[model samples]
Target: MVDHRQRRDELIDVVWRLIVEDGLAGITIRRVAERSGWSSGAVRHYLPTREAILDAAAQRVAELIEERIKAVDASAPPLDALVAVLAAVLPTDEQIQRASLVWLAFVGQAASDAGLADAQGILYRDLNQLLVELLTMLAAMGFQVDGGPASAAVELQAMLDGLTVHVLLGRVDADAAQEVLRAAVNRLLTRPPEADG
Candidate 1:
């Protein structure tokens, strides 16, 4: 028997790509169906409403991040592993670039959508917690956390976001972004933070 879940997933994938490329402004059941070579009725079978399509796209983004993190080897050094996690989210390659673009749209849409906003919050919280945990581990390893683990996580996350934007704008490359990410962590582990802009 054919799996209905798989078909739904396929439809979600099509919508997800649309969001990534078009930034969530023009997505509709008819558009998604046309993109996927199906009828609007068929797309509705998977996502009955525009809201459902948006939710599925947001969910796929989270799933993609989770899958990337899960693929990292745990035996690597803590700092190296952390860099891998951060780099995975950077717009360094075609796949990651697409994900990052889709992520921007997700953030914009989340402003008014309670459900999408909540999901974005949860993802942010989880990543922030992981960074905190990593910073704590570094401190345990005798690194000087100039401020504190909690504050360092917040700062590092903000830096990462800004760096990712620069990367998308062609002002920074993947290697440069990775270097900046590592240096930010190093500075947090060593020096005091600069005054907020």
Candidate 2:
């Protein structure tokens, strides 16, 4: 007998692949089952609705991203840690690039779909919290943030998001993106008031 967990994971994998290939519009019970070599009934047994499957896929992607960020070495300096976190978010290779494509598809689908929108909100909040934590650490390390921790966190998060979009759209290469981020961090960390004196 096939393990239910394994079967569910297979379904999610199939859904992710479909999303990468054809966006959210490409995912349906029959299509996913066909891609995974599972029966439609089996797919339905695991995910009774399209929304459920999408929510599962989104959650899985979030978990994978969190896992990647967590794998970075926390013992490094705050600047190094921040760079590592940003690097994890960027699609530097083929596997991560595919994941990024799936994420873009999910975001577009979530914009008009109320159910998926809620999941997207949760993921955004979680990611923002992670960024806030990183920003707070930077502040502790004497970074001269223009505003309070919360504001700095939001700004840095926005910058990272913009960079991700540019990189994914081919407007910026990975090396150029890294340099931009590094320059921004350097500017953020430099003590302007001290330099003025």
Candidate 3:
């Protein structure tokens, strides 16, 4: 007999494939059941409502991203570790590009759905916290974070977000994106505040 948890995972996998292949509008209980070779009722047994399925999918995506970041070597320098985290978030290749597409789709959907928006808020807050921690570490490493690290971290996070969107839209290649990010990091690390005359 198949494990229930396994079945649920299969459903989530099917949902992700459907989202990647057919876009967000393609995820229905009937479609998922057909794709997963399960009955409609069986799929519903795992995810009773469309919203529930979407919520589960969003959470699964977040978990996968977190897992990828967790696998990076943290013993590296803080800037290097932060770059690893940023690279993990970028669409550097096919696998990551697909994941980025799925994430973007969910983000668009979340704009209109209150429940999804709330779920997205949680993910965003977690990512922001991670960025803040990295920036704090960089400050400890002698990087000048003028006016405190939090504001600088927020600015860096915005830059990263803009870079990811550019990568996803094919406006920037991975190498160019990396160069741009490195330049931004260097400037942030080296630029000094204007001194009074």
Best by TM-score: 2
Residue-level lDDT tens digits of model 1 in 78-108: 6677778887778777866777777777778
Q: lDDT tens digits, residues 72-158, model 2?
A: 998876677777787787778776776677777767888798877886776677878987777776666666666766776677767
- lDDT per residue as tens, model 3, 90-162: 7777766766777777778888878878766656777788878877877766667655667766776677778
Question: How far out, in Å, is residue 67 in model 2?
Answer: 1.5
Lowest-sum lDDT 10-residue window in model 2: 188-197
What does the lDDT read for residue 46 in candidate 1?
81
Candidate achieving higher lDDT, 1 or 3: 1
Better of 1 and 2 by TM-score: 2
Please, what is the TM-score per model?
0.83, 0.86, 0.84
State in Å the error of residue 85, model 2. 0.7
Error of 3 at 188 (Å): 2.3
Q: State the lDDT at 23 in candidate 2.
A: 87
The window of 10 residues in a row where model 3 has the poorest summed lDDT is 188-197
Candidate 3 to truth, TM: 0.84
Give lDDT per model, in order. Answer: 0.79, 0.78, 0.76
For residue 99, model 3's alpha carbon misses the true position, in angstroms, by 1.7
